[model samples]
Target: MNKKVTILNDKHQRPPEFSAGSCTVTVYSLQPWWRVDLLAQYQISSVVITNRVDCCSQRIDGAEIRIGNSLENDGNNNPRCAVIKYTSDSSSYNFSCNMIGRYVNVIIPQNGTTLTLCEVEVYGVLGAISLQTDVALGKIATQSSSSYPMFLAPFAIDGNRDSNVYAMSCSYTDYYFKPWWRVDLLIEYQISSVVITNRGDCCPTRIDGAEIRIGNSLENNGNNNPRCAVITDIPAGSSSTFSCDMIGRYVNVVIPKNGAILTLCEVEIYGVPAVTKKINLRVKFHTSEDMIDSTTRHNVFQQFQMVSALKLYWTQEPELEHENKGFSDPSPVHYIQR
Candidate 1:
C-alpha cells in the first residue's frame, strides 16, 4: 500500500553566517539582537554560536541565547536558554536549550553594545503515541488560519502527537489577531481534562497564554465560550494535561492577543458524552420470497412477527496482537503535497 509520513529530522542544513566584523555589528543600539527562523518547529537541543575572530571578541560578552516560537521583542522576548558571561577569541560556545521552537535569537541587553557572530548552529531532533479514550479523536477541528494546507486544523484531532508539523501531525495557524483553534465534539460533555502536545520540532512557546474555553456557544468562533483554563507554558516535545471540569460541546484554544499564531500537535477531550449509556436497535425484515420480488414493495412488519431488538453496552473485547508500526495521519496521502 502506498503511504506518506513525516519522520523526525536531524541537523543537516548549513548554519547561518552573519560574517560580522568582530566589533562592527550591533553597535550603539539598545537591545541589539539577531534571530533566525528554522521555517518549521523542532525540539531544540542546543545552540552553538561562533564569535568573530578578527578582533573585539569582548563585544560578544553578556550576549543572551533565547529560543522560542514568538518573535516578540525581535525574538529576544523568548525564553532565555542561556547567557554568555564572556567569550574568548574566535571560538565557539555551545549552550543547551532543550526547548522546542522555530526561532533562535541572540540579544545584547546593554545599550550601545556591539554583537557579532561568525556562525550560528542550532542542533535539534525533528518529528517523532498513546491509546486514548480521547473524545476529540477524529472530531471536526478548525483553526483561525492555516500557515499552509499541510498544517490544517483537523490534524490536531487525528490521534497523533508527533509534535512535528512536517510530520503532518500538528495543526498550525498563520499570524493573526487573537488566533484560535477549536474542536467540535458533536455533543456536550462534562469535560475533565485537556491534554495538549506542543510542537516539538519548533515554536512550542506559541501555545502559551492560550485560553481553553468550553461551551455550546459559537460566539466569537467558540472563543467566547466559558473559560476552562488558561495555559501558562508547555515545554517542547512535552505533553501537558490541564484539568478542565466544564460542560460544553465545543472546546476552543484562543490566544487572546494580536499577532499570534496558534498551533496544536494534538488535542484530546475526555468526558461522558451527552447520551445514553446503552444502545438498542430494533428492526423487521421482509420475507425472502417478497425480497426476491423486484417490483412489489413489501410490508413485512404488518404481515410477520418482528425480530427481537439487539441491545449493547459500551465494552471492549481483547484486541488481537498487532505490530507497532510508526503511523500517524488521516488519509495518508501518498502523493507529495505541492
Candidate 2:
C-alpha cells in the first residue's frame, strides 16, 4: 500500500494500521501465523484470502490454513484445511476449508517466516445446526483395564470437558495390550459424531492412534466394531469431534497397540435415536425358543387364536332392494396371506 496510508479514504496516502486497505505485517519470527476469532463456532465452508497486493505476494506460499476451537500453540495446532502451495499467479486466493471452528488461522510452517495478509474472509453456517446434545452423559462406561480408582471409566462420560487430569481427573486404563474405553448407550443410536477431550496436564500424545468405533458387537470387547475415525492429534486441552455416522449401542475408544495406556478427559457422543424396525415374525410351533422376546416384549412364537365368530345372514331377493343395496360383503378363504 501507499507508505502514507491512513484511516478511511483520508489517505495521506497513509492508511490506518489496522483497518481496511491496510495489511497485517509481522516482524522476523519463526513460523509466524495470523488468526481471526469469530467468537462462536461455525461450520466453515470456505475461506477467501487477499494477499499483500502491493508487493511480496509470494510470501503467502507454503502457508497453511487451519480451523478449530483451539488456541493451543497460538492456534496453529488446529487441523489444517489447505496449504497455499503456489499462489504466485494471483493476489486473491480462495480455498475450500469445509471445517468447523471458532477461529481461522493462517500460518507459515517453516522457520524464519513472516505472514502478511491484507484481508481474510471466512464463510460458514451458524453453529446451531452444527452442534448437538451429548448422548453419553451419565451413561455406563467401562475400560479394558484399570489400576487407578480416580481415573476409572465413568469419569469420561460425566459430562465434563476439563482437559486437566489433575483438576478433573479423566478416565484411564492400565498399561495393557490394545487398551480401550467403552460406553454403553443402553439403547442403539444412530451416532453422528463423538467429541473426545485429551489430557492437558501431560501425555497428550498418548491419545494418538486411538480409533473411535461404534457397533453392537462386543467381539474383542467392542474394539472390533466398525471404525469412525483415527486420532491424529488434538491440541492440548482441546476437544475434537470425529464424525461417526454409525449405528450402535456401544461406542469404543481403542488404541490398537500393545502395552499402551488409554486416557480420556471427556467423551461426548451426539446423535439421534436409532429408528426401531419391526422384528421378523418368529414363526414356531414346537421350538424351545421363548414365546416372547425378553427385551422387545413382542410375540416370538406363533399362537393359534380364533378370529371373531360372526353370524352370517344373507338375502338374495330382488324385492328387498332398499335393505340389500348398501349391505356389506365378507369373504373368507381357506388360507391366510400373512
lDDT of each: 0.68, 0.70
Worst 10 residues of 1 by lDDT: 329-338
Candidate 1 lDDT, 64-87, residue by residue in tens: 777778987778878666556453
Candidate 1 lDDT score relative to the true structure: 0.68
Q: Candidate 2: deviation at residue 321, Å?
A: 41
After superposing candidate 2, which stretches have Cα over 4 Å from the reference?
Answer: 1-124, 127-131, 279-338
Candidate 2: residue pairs that collide = 4-13, 4-14, 5-13, 5-14, 5-15, 6-14, 6-15, 6-16
Runs with alpha carbons beyond 4 Å of true place in candidate 1 = 1-132, 275-338
- Candidate number with greatest lDDT: 2
lDDT of 2 at 126: 69
What C-alpha lDDT, on a 0 to 100 scale, does residue 136 get in candidate 1? 89
Angstrom error of the Cα, residue 247, model 1: value is 0.9
Instruction: Please report, as a residue range, the 10-residue window in candidate 2 with the lowest summed lDDT.
Output: 1-10
The per-residue C-alpha lDDT of model 2 at residue 153 equals 93
TM-score to true structure, per model: 0.44, 0.52
